[model samples]
Target: MSEKAMTDIRNDPAAATRHDIALSIDKVRGVLEALRFGSITLTVHDARVVQIDVTEKTRLHA
Candidate 1:
């Protein structure tokens, strides 16, 4: 995406609040909710979320 195209934000507050944030949030929430042992890594680019990485660890009980 072009610099202008990427930084283009000409709309209301709701418009500014797009799925980018919402979806990322939902994903983060989901990971946290179902995570018992693991880590969540967020990748950001140009102030935007570019990726979401989840590392889940399985625990064995004695």
Candidate 2:
């Protein structure tokens, strides 16, 4: 398995907040096709995606 992205989920603050869900699926086909290498980072708040970041992967052989 490989580390695809970094996820940071935080609680939401609302006066009438009842419930919140957290989940997201990114269309990596484009990214993979474009760069052919990178990483992904996803941030969510109150079950909503807030941020996303992509970088290069680092692999080492033993």
Candidate 3:
């Protein structure tokens, strides 16, 4: 199978405040592109994405 570019955002915030700080698709795409190739883990707390970690992939394909 061919590899396809994709982004997965896991919304772990509370139900009520989930819609308060919504990220646009374009913004998200730009963020991912800026990081180049790697893995990013979004850390969320209190209905907000507080941190981002860009780590290199250890294996050939992960």
Could you tell me the lDDT of residue 52 within candidate 1?
A: 84
Global lDDT scores for all candidate models = 0.77, 0.48, 0.54
Candidate 2 clashes between residue pairs 3 or more apart in a chain or in different chains: 5-40, 21-47, 39-55
Per-prediction backbone clash count: 0, 3, 0
The candidate scoring highest on lDDT is 1
Better of 1 and 3 by TM-score: 1
lDDT of 1 by residue, 1-62 (tens): 45554455443444445736877888889889999999999999866688989899999999
lDDT of 3 by residue, 1-62 (tens): 12221111233334324433455334556678877567777777865666666675555655
TM-score, candidate number 1 = 0.62
Question: What is the clash count of model 1?
Answer: 0
| TM-scores, all models, native as reference | 0.62, 0.37, 0.41
Model 3 spans > 4 angstroms off: 1-20, 23-27, 57-62
Q: What is candidate 2's TM-score against the reference?
A: 0.37
How well does candidate 3 score on lDDT at residue 7?
16
